[model samples]
Target: MPLDVESLRSHFPSLASGIAHFDGPGGTQTPRVVGQAIADTLTGPLSIRGSSVASERNADQAVLSFRSAMADFLNADPSGIVYGRSATQLTYDFAKHLSTGWGPDDEVVVTRLDHDCNVRPWVQAAERRG
Candidate 1:
């Protein structure tokens, strides 16, 4: 089924204000569930347990849950999905790893249309590796 816009809007607390959200290209507002999940991860009972087997299990479950949700949303292989602070950072990190397979004569093509966050990191990585 197609996503119900009204229902999806209801899930996001920030949308209640009817604010103009033109900043989506940079970052979109997160839903209430995302905020609560983060709180639970940081402050819930599972986080308080000191190296207990149950705590480890809970942490593992949390990671698996996050991965599954991301895979579902992106229609991607969960193993191929990497979590990072931003797409720019992730691409830079990937470039560093990939650069190891390249040599001094190899060239990396980057475009000016990209955001500085995306461009600068890869440029820095290429320079450092070279």
Candidate 2:
């Protein structure tokens, strides 16, 4: 089924500006409710994530719940699910890590159709390896 973009837009205040955003690979405006939730959490009884105390346990649960939610959404193990600042950062990090296995003759084909954030990382990583 197609998603209701209009319905989704109601939660994102940035959409009110009538600007179309396609730069989500690097950064994107978060929904207003998400921003509100974050503010609420920060202002609430938050503490370092651990099993030592009530606040700590709350923090730990938040982290674990986020991981679990992401895992369920992706249909992957929670242990395998990871979050980064942006797709650009994750792609760059992975490219750098994967480049160690590439030989001088190895070629990576990143289409021009891809966002620059996706293309530059691999190219830079491969160049660094070479």
Candidate 3:
């Protein structure tokens, strides 16, 4: 079945403004449902994720729910899901972790097509390993 572009776009209220958004690394506009969820969470009782208090429990549940949803969508384990502030941060972290296992014989390959954010982390990690 062909995907309905209009139907998908309808969920994003920002699209109605007719401004084309080509940037994803800087962060894409949130869909109405996601925006509403974020607003609700921010407006609701919030505390560090824990089970000691109601606010803490609420925060904990939000984290678990986000991880669970991501896991389901990615077909991965929820426990393995590590949320980062951005793709660059995650790339840097993973590069550093993986570089620790690298030896002199191992090579680090980065393409020119990769964004600077993606390339710099690997290069830095390789330098650190050396």
CA lDDT, every model vs. true structure: 0.72, 0.82, 0.86
TM-score of 2: 0.77
**What C-alpha lDDT, on a 0 to 100 scale, does residue 11 get in candidate 1?**
79
Which has the better lDDT: candidate 1, or candidate 2?
Answer: 2
Candidate 2, residues 1-130, lDDT tens digits: the string is: 9999889989888879888677554236788877887787677777988898878887777778878998999898998877655778898899998999999999989887788998999999988978
How do the residues 31-126 of candidate 1 rate in per-residue lDDT, one tens digit apiece? 888788788886754643234677666766676777788999999888876665677778778878877877778777778776666677778777
Global fold similarity of model 3 (TM-score): 0.74
The better-scoring model by TM-score among 2 and 3 is 2
lDDT per residue, candidate 3, 88-117, as tens digits?
999988998889998887888988876778
- What residue pairs clash in candidate 1, if any at all? none
Error of 2 at 3 (Å): 8.4
Stretches of candidate 1 off by over 4 Å are 1-28, 46-52, 83-89, 111-116
Clashing pairs in 2: none
lDDT of 2 at 118: 82
- Order of the predicted models by lDDT, top scorer first: 3, 2, 1
1 or 2, which is superior by TM-score? 2
Clashing pairs in 3: none
Candidate achieving the largest lDDT: 3
Per-candidate TM-score against the hidden true structure: 0.61, 0.77, 0.74
